[model samples]
Target: MSERTHDGGVAVTAAPSPDESLPAADLAAKYGLAVSGARPSLVEYVRQLWGRRHFILAFSQAKLTAQYSQAKLGQLWQVATPLLNAAVYYAIFGLILDASRGMSHDTYVPFLVTGVFVFTFTQSSLMSGVRAISGNLGLVRALHFPRAALPISFSLQQLQQLLFSMIVVFLVVIGFGNYPRLSWLLILPALVLQFLFNTGLALIVARMGAKTPDLAQLMPFILRTWMYASGVMFSINHMLEGRPEWIVRVLQANPAAVYMDLMRYALIDGYGAVNLPPHVWALALGWAVVVFCGGFVYFWKAEERYGRG
Candidate 1:
């Protein structure tokens, strides 16, 4: 309303806004506004992740390709790296230290190589996952996609690298007299289970890394300790013989050892069915399902905080 003033000036009064009756929260709610970067429901988050599956796959492939881009041998290093590590282990453990006291040369060679390759899958996944968020902060901060994708894609990248190395694994096994047979088909399920387990582990570490960037520096020593305990270079059964049945069982049941045992059992003829932990398949399946689901939820619980400083 406008009114004439005593001299020549006019005064105007503003009308009330229609929205004055609504609180800010109610106004936002009524307009379908939400807090940016807020976490979705678990099921909805899973759907969002699934919606970005193609991005996940392409990102993994790109990372795998670039991993060896600067090396002279390029992708050959994927296989050669593990093979060389196997050779070094063979010289030290199989030759000098006599770690293969029970198994013959053929059995020991294939066993060592298989352990190196399988363990590398888990090792690389962990190393990559530990940096998945911290190493790619730009992407994490600029993008709005699921934060889990980075770690999951890194795990997938390691899985792809392992698949490439499997060619050499097959040659090593066949050269050692483990010809392909009906049981060889078990590699599929074993790899699937291992991939799930690796992905779960990756997700767990990614969340940790995002918060504690210093963790990236600490992971190597931790993984090295895990590798040694996992029997990557020798038979746990042989090394721990007489260490008490329960202790041996506990080490054998560790997820890393379990996956390596499954691969060795599937790929090598002389891996000895007798050495396998009881109910090995059940253990593998249980580890895969439990870790993957638990890690997914654990990571999702902190979704909104991932890219924050």
Candidate 2:
């Protein structure tokens, strides 16, 4: 209540009574408090994540370091692992299946190595993403940040590893007598699109595996099937030649095959327009857009549900 004083027309205000109930808003404002455990809007979440960019990079590098910490050769194993796989594939697909008979022995090794390294990038990114959130529950519980960072950092860790392995890849290309060309500029665009595509897959699977942890186990078999379909070891065009047009289109349009074809066209003399699918760039750009946006939205929709369970 406010009262006027007799002296000099002064006004005085009375304090609230002890028995009067304080308004919730007034109490909160007085205490400078906020809602606990409230989820932010998607925009706010993204902003929060952006604010933590350094943390993401550091987390990714740390994981990359820890990946080989137990191994004797350390980072060399990253390059050696895929190269060894190439050797085995070269044996089976190169020897038993006679897939290498058509291409020059000179470029075929480079072609196979490129496919192994490129595909392994996506494979490793997604595999780590499948476990990103579920595997880091301790950190998740101990911290409060956007869970999306986990998958994104995992994808980045793989990309960093891929770049490291690319040092060996370029050497292998040179060892086989291929030199860098104007066409090699295409590797940037190819890796960019593929990285975006892998990030999308990572987010999609991270959310999925968060709910169904078994996805981690099942992904390898699914990826193995994908590798066969992607034509990592052999030219699928020959096998798909006699098939119906739709099947041929499907095989050619597979993202993994499109990327490998792009790299071969960029890096190898024998693998270009004659074997390339029509509109390869269009197919690649479409896959990147569709998967990345769709997966980001799908993942963001579950922002509040991530660590509660």
Candidate 3:
């Protein structure tokens, strides 16, 4: 069999003449599966990711800093915006509606803060993903980096905001005398899961939005509707009142809602003593895997296309 070096590692063998059957090694080598150095498998994919973890971190940090660099407030906007939103909502819901009839006024602030904080990350991910390619057309055409990095960077920027918002939420919770409990430790893993979810979503939308700019305009309405449907202002349990079990199930199926509930339970309810249902967590995980794998495949398919202006 005729062999050629592929990527300076594997020997890729060409198909044999019509009369001769290619050996397995030759066939495998043809597909870049030679024993010497095979193409990456899923495990290798993760290892490759691990090796480049620094790049991701650095890129994300740079993006975060660059976004705020031009602003007078700089990174303080990350803390300020969420706090402002919480205050507005608190005024309307707490003062006008007196909505905290059952819940304490102070407790309601953190609850709303947590919901808005989490929802803002999702909004930023989806909205930025929608504009990712269009907004970075110059970078896309001029540079060669992972296309996923654009949306990933945007999501990470929002994640930085989320982290800052969480600090504010923690302070608000403390001031309210709601000291964190051991159960609050779950926030670490929950935040990780939330990040995975956001990255996956950004990947999906960035690719789709690259092809259709209309999504950029359409995303905000969708996000607003999602904010309402997600029970950001009121509790999901309250919204689902008198609705059928299946309807509640359908609403709960929203992975964002599940995460919101988890965040509320951990940070607000104190380690989910009320306990977010297992199915909710399972659904969140399932969506994360599906979105990540599917979006990665879809985005990678257009990797070469991203270079086109």
Candidate 4:
């Protein structure tokens, strides 16, 4: 038997005697207390995140500002760093290493610049994802919001940075005699798919980094190797000419290389569908969907465990 208290009819019950036992489920239902750190269902989790859209956008912008606040170059570094790297590659590949592989000077420069800028978006997203949870442990522990926010906001920050750099990319393209075309419209969908892909990658890496923390140390080398293999400074097709057909197809189909090829076909004159592997857009969309759906579920599964350790 129980007596009601004045505080919203909360029950006051006598303590159980040694002979009595209370069912945990019944007690929980009566008291309405959920298990601490319980994960939400996917639909509910997404609803909660949607309720916090302002916070995510604001946080992303704040992080972007803070990243360049101390540097004398400020936001200029975002554009300059990639341009400088492109210049160095121009000298090395175009001149010394012969990575240009007989492509016209105009064509190779634009190709390299667009590839560097586009690829860096994904590279930066993964790098920042590694730190998203680990770097914000204090906030994660103190706040009741979704942990996915951190990784997603980090991805947005990178996206904003890349958008800023795209202006320079267009200028570089114009300088090399590649003007706008109907194909350039494809960049819109291409970038949208890539953003999804990057977000998925960010979520996956954020979970991994939150646990291991050592993954961050190895990412740089991994990205560097990927850069070389992605045909950023040179054409993988030209490099692998006369090689087995399957081998050439495999490299072209890689997500990174596929994205670079799409952008090249869109922005650089004469780099069209024929130069690309079959089903380029289809492969890009497939990778984006698979990675995003898989990554979101993967990260959501670990929601409750993110900040505890």
Q: In TM-score terms, which candidate is top?
A: 1
Clashing pairs in 2: none
TM-score of each: 0.96, 0.88, 0.79, 0.93
The clash count of every prediction, one per candidate, is 0, 0, 1, 0
Instruction: For residues 1-309, write the lDDT of model 3, one tens digit per residue.
Output: 545576666675877575358878678767776543223454554566566667777877887778779999998888888779878888987789765555666667777888888888888878877788878898777764566677877787788778867888888777876787876887887777888888888988898898888988889998989987876676655545688877776776787887887788877653243335457667777877888777777766676666465
Q: Relative to the unseen true structure, what is the C-alpha lDDT of residue 58 in candidate 3, on a scale of 0 to 100? A: 85
> How far is 136's C-alpha from truth in model 2 (Å)?
0.2
Q: Cα RMSD to native, each candidate?
A: 1.6, 6.4, 9.3, 5.9
- How far in Å is the alpha carbon of 33 misplaced in model 3? 19
**Sort by lDDT, best first: what order?**
1, 4, 2, 3
Off by over 4 Å in 4: 1-20
On the 0 to 100 scale, the lDDT of residue 148 in model 2 is: 90
- What ranges in model 2 sit over 4 Å off? 1-35
List, residue by residue over 31-132, the lDDT tens digit for candidate 1. Answer: 999999999999999999999999999999999999989999999999999999999999999999999977899899999999999999999999999899
Residue pairs in clash, model 1: none
Candidates in order have lDDT scores of: 0.93, 0.88, 0.75, 0.90
Error of 4 at 171 (Å): 0.5
TM-score (C-alpha) between model 1 and the true structure: 0.96
CA shift at 261, candidate 3, in angstroms? 1.0
Candidate 1 Cα outliers beyond 4 Å, as residue runs: 1-10
Better of 1 and 2 by TM-score: 1
lDDT of 4 by residue, 135-176 (tens): 899999888998998999999999899988999999989999
- Where does candidate 4 have its weakest 10-residue lDDT segment? 12-21
